[model samples]
Target: MACFHPLTMMLTLVLAARLAAAVPFKNESYPLTTVPGERPWNPIEPLQQRLAYINATAMAVSWNTYTSLPDEEAVVYFGTDAWELDRTAPSRQSTFETSRTFSHHAILSGLEPGTEYHYRVAHTNCFGCSTIPTYSFTTALPAGDCTPYAVAIVADMGLMGPDGLTNSTGKGAGGALLDNETNTIQSMVQSLDAYEHIVHIGDLAYADYFLKASTQGFYGADNVLTNATSIVENYERLNEAWYDQITPLTSQRPYMVAVGNHESNCNNGGVKDKVNNISYTAQICMPGQTNFTAYAEHWNMPGRPGPSQNFWYSYDVGMVHYVVLSFETDLGEGLYGPDEVGGTGKQMSGPRGKTGEQIEWLRQDLAKVDRKKTPWVLAFGHRPWYVGIADAVCEPCRLAFEGILYENNVDLVLTGHDHVYSRSVPMFNHTADPAGYDNPRAPTYITNGLGGHYDGLDVLDSPLPANVAHGIDGVYGWSRLTFANATHMRHEFVAARNSSVLDEFWLVRAREEGTCVDGEEGHTGKDNGKGHGKGGKKDKRDVLARLDE
Candidate 1:
């Protein structure tokens, strides 16, 4: 028999203990609250109803049904009045083989901008369809409209209840668990009037985490079953629970999202195999787990034609242009590539070749923005380029898209992944702009991933980076961005528990004439530096007329 050294034996035991501690065990006894009246009266009853913006004149409505319906029967009826739904639009149905239910979607088009419309989703073939209650949503303001609007930003939010809290403490990053949701959800519900839409950067639900724990026997010996049938039912319940939890908000506003590492693989741990010594895992991955199947099928974003369309897209809301990018894949070599998870080579989304397609698309999109019409450009993704945690910082993502964003003068960039909140001064290449928030030349970066989730908070690096303006890890909260006008925007980080303002700042920029100075053809006048009236007020009508050329 081989004898091991005492020191080696001691180290081996310590490593094992840490590994066991890192694995989260399921609390089977924790009570999960059922959504009021969520039990379907029929197999075709819709749940998890959500809305997304397609354009100024259109909005997309989607919901989940236990059973698939005929394409012609998946329809929405709508009108401006709640009593009479005078319009109808046919819908399309889709589902992943790994999913137990079908998703139905329909677009309400020819809508008036900024007008509230009441609608109801139903299957015409079903009996007593009129009993479905009516829901209402407002269309986005037309581009070039300088009306003020606010948007809510959240990330890393998991399913409400015990699943979202730390198992040992039975609490979140904030304090005691108040109800099913973290402070973020309660806060948003209380201040519904504060924002018109919600931008969920990524990690919508912890479904994959649940699946991982169940397959690894963390849920209990009886929950160790990982068959295809078990996996499908596992995700179905988790997805429905999360979507139902947020229906109060998503049903009323456009719930925009981007892809995160949690959305990449089934196990939510990373890839399972190895390529040339680099490890990747596909051990428990099922059909719908990879390729963002569930996320893509559930959402119908207005994405341009490309393999990464659902992952990367842009939309204009009032005076701000919002661009969503994927930090999980299509980002060429280095960490955050398809073959890695959270920068660790231990797990991955497998070998997805980099085509540089996303970056190229970003370039074209940013190049086409006419700043004279929409003065503020905000880009958001799942991972952060500037954060307090070193490991959480994605240098590869910064290398890929920072130059283009800076060149185009993107006003702000939002990201989540660190589970802590940190804001950086307007910076490029790690250097803070001397002008700061006052007409800065570079984008101001913020990591607002503190929307409470199962993993709890991430510890920030001591001696925080010089560029970080504000950093917090103890509290669970979300940020609100108010596009006050063409020249002024305000951002506030609000505490989830009490709805207190934790941090606030104003980003001010002068509306320069010929702001189309980014080399887009049309106006050739130089910046007079006197603000809007320097050449004459160029309103929406003037911008629209020029675009008609």
Candidate 2:
């Protein structure tokens, strides 16, 4: 990181380090005016990394103005090209809900798909304050069957640039924080990205603050039992340090994301004790609002969960049907979910019924998927029902939907909860389908929980799933899912250790047509669907077990 004032270049466009280093003087003549600094303007929330939305006829921009700036209008300049600071889309910042952060949304209509637009933000008037740069995002691709070269898959990126906790172990040149899940995200702050679209598997920044009484402002953890309170105050002081890590990468790419268990109130004993994080829901300028307001405001993600009836939505992205489901609660957990457990000393609930809803939605969603319209059906959630890791407390819970998906011929399953990467064989009933080798068998499964988390790496309690050719661990990395034409897709593990491909392989959907991920059989003599990956080879493990028999 170096600094040199250009004797040749003028100050019209100052590129100052985001740190507190004296901002390179642009001009004393045009002192930054408007947006009174009396109340902190601060870094905007739900920071956009790489926005990869579709040609939404109407796209909105929104935010919060903190409690002190009681009166102001939320404005956005629009149009496809930069420079011409014309087109105005204005919405008054309405003072709503409780708390100090004033939420806002401004939906701009008539935006063309696959096109870029630039805009600026202001409260009092669009002047003087550090000018919100000319940011542009490409809307989601049109709804049809087409193919893009590559898509980056990253999980557990909770809006921080660093991994928070520091530890040194075995990352070749010694371990740096990036060594274990570095924020080398290819989104935000760039001239478009090589990846047309990206998917953030889960666990976004633990946003729970206004001007969180910390040096940086906010912490990047989930807002579960803690709400957005200061219990994680120490985490807040880390904003400056973390933001310095990822924004550069994510801002450059068009990103699609999945929710992690940490984003909402997973630990609260009572229902009301739980809060819907505005940080996890809502897009700026949209009329809707929520608990994780910061997330909804800044990221402007669509179809979030909760009483808002927003979570678990799907869209089309060039030859693929991108389905995002919420496993944090939508799927279910006896102690933490579904039926609303006991309210006393211990809270316990059966599987959340959203599974059934999503199951039905999946049926309808997939039913609507005319192969001609969107050829590849790719579904993802935060929790990976089948992983290599084992829990000492209890056997890991397998997803109830694996059976449904297998029966439906899903092309791929992607997840992020486990903080390490693990890829399973083309399995149906927890065993590899030798049929996986031919044209028309079972769907393929890819696990890339390695995008980076402080939880450390995960080791398999079981053996490799049949033909799992490649795997890596003890290092941090992100997954890249590359689509090669219609019938072929490749998964590569990009290690932050050195940005190298730790593990890479191809999944030929046209090659394995009838395969399923139903899990292995149990003593009950029925397909219990528990994640039991095959019993060795040769004389034992049955191919596609249940189906083979």
Candidate 3:
């Protein structure tokens, strides 16, 4: 038997008590402004990268300020080629829930397409602070043009550390860590010359300090399990670091995004249901706010028909009609019953008599896809309707949206959430509708959720579903889509660690005049003027009839 000293025993008892009383979010500090030199007057310069709405000939920029100054206003100065010192866009200022931090968003409109513009963001009253450096961005190619472009897709991108422990600023998980995932995609940054659009499916900056501590075995993981104040403070810190990491690349291109489960907390985007992500709503500001508040506050996205800003929306880039949606809300994840492990009830909101709003929205959106005009209709969301993972399957999600995707003849359906890279054989209704590479009859489903997060990666099922073509896990990577032209497009998975091309395939558009065309040309996926594609007066009233039954 070993004898313990009285002092040692006392210390051990104290430690045990402390651990036992640890709260999930119990920070005593009121405001945690971690950004160096973050002043209430000057504030931290807009850290998040600028997001572009190319179709509207405008760009939206946002940043965080520690405190608000009386009569203080946020402004962005811009001009073609150089800052003409003439044109200015005033910002709409508002405060977030995390702290007294003020958020500012300014939209610079009336710009020309495919043209260069220089700009700077600043406080209207900060007289002594040096002006923010000028950044340049070129507007996207004019809409309706048969121009060639590429889109880079990344998801679940969490904190990046330099020594696998600390980030560029020598901070670890508890601070503004580096985005190694972004570092891995540096080549994609270089490829930016060709890829102008960057789309993040979901799960941006896993700063869930307020939720609970992460036990996924990563050091300095910013999960403060004891303090609420520290939680918000650490959140702002991690967020600032995240914005800084992507600023360099995003400043030059358009960064589009979709919401995921992580953003479902505490009024984040005005939501507090089965999923509660208060941080997401407070952080991201998009176009549609009456329903989704935070998102509406930040982004000036195009094609917002009202109601929900980040819920579901559509826009056209070059020859592609891009649809962005929210799976957490769109799939009725919050409306399910018992909230138990497996026992569930009602996948969507409202009774079963009528199709839900999202389903109806989808039907109308898909019915309007004029292949001849845009050539390809690509739909993206955070969660995948069809995925083959041992513990991450969402059958209800499939039941919710797969039918609409198939009925619409969408070319490619991209999703993230499974934390792995997977491509399904052109699939429709649980069968492998062989449309391999060229003219896929069924939309090809690809999951690129391996964006390197501390929560770890997902495992693959021993035997994949019959419709799954390829699947890989235990790797970090992103997906790339190259719109070769109106008729052909290429998709590839690039390993982030080394920028290696992991998987590649080509999706050919089925033209009305041909059997299965592979080369680029006009009339990519036109409506054929038969009430199917475009300009068809096919009674759209039946949009929800299928769902009702």
Clashes of 2: 68
lDDT of 2 by residue, 1-549 (tens): 011124312222442222223211111222121111112334332222234353334554544444434333455666655556467766544443333345454556676543455555444432344333455554544444232445677777543333332343222122235433333342222212335556777665533221221112212343223333433332332322233244334343445556554444222222221133223221121111223232333344454433323246677754567877655543433323221233221223223344356556666776776555456778787776555563411112244557666776778888776666777666666677676634445666676766543334565555644455445666667776665545666677876545667777667756233221111111111111222211112112332131122
- Residues 195-260, model 1: lDDT tens digits: 778999998877766644443333334443457666666665676667766776777788899877
How high is each candidate's TM-score? 0.81, 0.67, 0.72
Off by over 4 Å in 3: 1-44, 54-56, 69-72, 83-85, 128-131, 162-191, 209-225, 266-298, 303-307, 332-355, 513-549
Better of 1 and 3 by TM-score: 1
Give candidate 1 regions above 4 Å deviation: 1-39, 129-131, 166-182, 211-223, 270-281, 305-307, 332-354, 514-549
Q: What lDDT is reached at residue 72 by model 1? A: 89
Q: lDDT of all predictions, in order shown?
A: 0.70, 0.46, 0.56
TM for candidate 2 is 0.67
Q: Which digits, one per residue and each the tens of the lDDT, describe model 3 over residues 416-436?
A: 888788888787877777657
